[model samples]
Target: MNNLKYSICYISFFFLFMLSMVNFMMMIHFIMNNMVIFLEWEIISLNSTMIIMSILLDWMSLLFMMFVFLISSVVIYYSKSYMSSELNLSRFIILVLLFVSSMMLLIISPNIISILLGWDGLGLVSYLLVIYYQNLKSYNAGMLTALSNRIGDVLILMVVSWMLNYGSWNYIFYLEFMKNDWEMKMISSMIILAAMTKSAQIPFSSWLPAAMAAPTPVSALVHSSTLVTAGVYLLNRFNYLLVDTLPLKILLLMSGLTMFMAGISANYEFDLKKIIALSTLSQLGLMMSILSMGLPDLAFFHLLTHAMFKALLFMCAGVIIHLMSDMQDIRFMGGISIYIPLTSLCMNISNMALCGVPFLAGFYSKDLILEMVSFSNLNLMVFFLYYISTGLTMFYTIRLTMYLMVNDFNLISVYNLYDEDYIMLKSMFILLLMSVVSGSFLSWMVFSYPYMIYLPFNLKMMVIYVSLMGGLLGYLISNMMIHSMNKFIQTYNLSSFLSLMWFMPNLSTYGLSYYFLNFGQNLLKIMDMGWSEIYGGYGMMKIVKKYSIFHGVFEMNNLKIYLFSFILWMFFVLLMLMM
Candidate 1:
């Protein structure tokens, strides 16, 4: 049965791979001619407005779908090995397929109503995937993932309700016409809110790392590529409506801060998967920041390249985790390249790409984004956040590399670690190849004209200076002898704060809900156990019993005789009056 399932997945991957290639060719043709194709079928009509199913096929959508399909295919192929020992391998594959379908739905739909189907689908399927292991950790992570995304889901539904004012659910048609409309502007704010939750920006950022509780392939496909990117893609589509708005500016500030915070958190992180997950968060912040800066194209460009390398990075982590008997701490993993050289090679390449090494997949997009930010007239804070975030990115990447590849082997001596699995390597190599070439390829294909960055010399070389400093610091700090670390015990609070992501995990998970949980407990005590008992069943019973006792007492006192005599006298008086 497992063999049959694997075969089916492989066939589907091959089919999608060929389809993406053809779609890419068609997208090129459409771009060359500046053409667009739209298809719609009406679902319902209310007065002058019609709710309809709609799909827009343009170069952007085509290219995005191409990447999505490619990544999904690779992730599915990779999962065959990763999930081979699981009893429910088929279930995992189906969930992944469903996730891909939802992502595709989101990509193609321009109609707000139609997009909900896809949006909700992604959320539901992701929750299921997150809890696939059925463990307590997976269960908690799944709930957090679902509820976090539900905020965006509710926002999208609200946006749909607001779209009724424009008499159409097709937001694409009305973006330009409703650009300055107060109602539309309000809708745009809600849309940004929705995007923030989906993209893991700011307060909504905690879910992304917690979601690493999912299987590694799910993390590769969903967290790294498809699911988290949904928000950026939505904002990219809705960029026209966000022009010069306060919400957009707020998005800029929050996303920039997210970029900085996530990078700092990654440097302090020790969990192998989580460190990579935090990097994904940082990249998402970069994309959101760029989108907020009115360059959705650049954001989308980074999105694609990031999808490639980040997915590859996660897959490499999966290989390591699988080999190490699920030990994810980087402290226990050193000189890993000695055994799993190919996996290490892929890891280094992806990490370097993540750091935006020259001519790599991440470089073209990240470099452009930094240069564009430098060129723009921005305040000191946003500017420094960009460069500092970039530097922090390199810092974490180097630190992670040093811990994994160069530090002493801290393993229990009995285990075997080797890159013997060809299946995992094959899946990883596909992404490795793409991560190496995709950035330069995308820069050429997406941007017909290069950005002419104008900045002073020091400002122009800012990324370089910060990156070099970051590299030096990463090496020095990561390589420091362990016993000497006691000197900084006084700064334990500050170090703990950074290590725990400013206590954000606590803030988002327990902090946000601790009051509610405490309130619930109090309510249970006062209402359910106390007041309700007194006021409801017990009180009613008491009243009934008291009346019964009074009646019994009255009967015991022979009150029925007095009651009969009084009634007879009243009846006689009434009879006499009638006569």
Candidate 2:
């Protein structure tokens, strides 16, 4: 069994890597020639309607596919060792392959129906992955993850129905037309709602952290490239429908709030995985908000770059979690850099990339995003959201770093901590190298011309300034102690509200589920068991019983009734003879 799992992992890794390389070459060729290939196969046609499956091969789709394959390859290779002890490792690798296939389908498809095929595939497979542990927490988290993505799936179905007006499911052709038609706005709105749910934007945001219940490899893949980014990719494809629209405005606000919310929530979180999950949420917000601002290129660029470092970060965290016997709280983790220097080095580099530190992978995209935000004619509220969220990102990154690498050891005495797993280290090294260079490499490849940033000195220095302040604040906050009184205790309500994701999890899970379940209970009682049963079934039975009793009484007087009936029969015979 172990040999089979190993063989499966190696086979998957090799296949995915070769595919990634091929896609990369194809992407470069497409970019150089400025070409797009659209292949459509018609399945059925009735009157004005046609059912056609489509695959769109453009630079964007190819590039995204390349990244997806690259990440999946490394993650699968990494998992060979990471999941070596599990009996069901082969099943896990197969599921991961299924997930990658789903993502690829989503990337290449132009038809809404085909997109939904991949979309639903991703949601279902992710739920299965999330619940792989077969425990209560995993079950609950899987439920949340599945249900959240289900909303997006429903919206996509609605989109498919709405697109029927055009007699085609190839929505790519009709995007420009959708922008002008008020009737078509409904489709766009539904699409945005779908994207929001899949991306875990505000109100639907609670499930991202909950999804950490999945194994670390799953988390690294899902959060970094495949699951959460599906929505962003969808919107990126549908960018034309969102230009200068109300849905775009709403998306902008929601995404900005999402960014801010995730940043603040991460600071208050202590669970290492949850913190990283929140950081993914935060970066997703960045991608979405930038996308909403009408720069799909920047959004796509960030999405690609973010994928590199974010996956590396999760891989590093996985190694630590594995070594620590599945302990995730950062409080119990301190100064393990002394023991696992290589892992620590990777983690710190990834963290710096996350903070958008200069010259790193994150910096290339993030700095450009900030500079663009400054360059655009935007309101103070939008401006504040952009910069403050940037700062909060750095703040959490520093705090997390300090806790893991700077503070003294707080775990049980005599814990084995080493970076000796060559498989895991090799996989991480692939991402670490990408995390260092992919940003600049993608920046040059993706953009035809560099964005000219003509900003004042103060405006140009804004990111740096905010980053410094945030880093200092993180250090101070991490070092500070409450000897006299606990401030969190003093401000219990505020702290709880902030720490609990503004009670979103409660609102999403209990608040909505309780009321709906209660309503359903009432419906079941009143409709199914009460009125329906009584009036439809029980009442009819009672009437039949009462009639039967009345007939029984008549039967009791059968002799007299028979004599009367004989006379009546004779009268009826005489009447028939006269006729």
The lDDT for every candidate, in the order shown, is 0.90, 0.92
Report, for all candidates in order, the number of backbone clashes.
Answer: 0, 0
The runs of at least 3 residues in candidate 2 whose Cα sits more than 4 Å from the true structure, single-residue gaps closed, are 481-490, 529-575
lDDT of 1 by residue, 1-579 (tens): 877878877887787788778889988998899889999999788788887899999999999999988988888888889998887777788888899899999999999987899999999999999999899999988988887899999999998888787778888987887798998899999999998999999989888999999999999998766889999999999999998999999999999989999998998889999999999999999999989999999999999999999999999999999998999999999998889999999999999999999989999999999999989888999998999999999889999999999998897989999788999999899999999999988888898788788889998888889999888878878887443553472277877988777787788778765676688999999999899999999889999999999787756657687788689989999999999
For model 2, what is the alpha-carbon lDDT of residue 449? 100
lDDT of 2 by residue, 1-579 (tens): 678879999999999999999999999999999999999999988897988889999999999999999999999999999998999888899899999999988999999999999999999999999999999999988988888889999999988987888888898988875578875788888989999999999989999999999999999999999999999999999998888899899999999999999998999999999999999999999999999999999999999999999999999999999999889999999998999999999999999999998889999999999999999987999999989999999989999999999999899997999889999999999999999999989999999999889999999999999999888878878887543334653378987888899899999889875687789999999999999888998889999999999888767868888789789999999999999
Residue range with the least summed lDDT across 10 consecutive positions in model 1: 481-490
User: lDDT score, residue 378, model 1?
Assistant: 88
In candidate 2, position 270 carries an lDDT of 96
Winning candidate number (TM-score): 2
TM-score of each candidate structure, all chains considered together: 0.90, 0.93
**What is the alpha-carbon RMSD of candidate 2 to the true structure?**
3.1
Top candidate (lDDT):
2
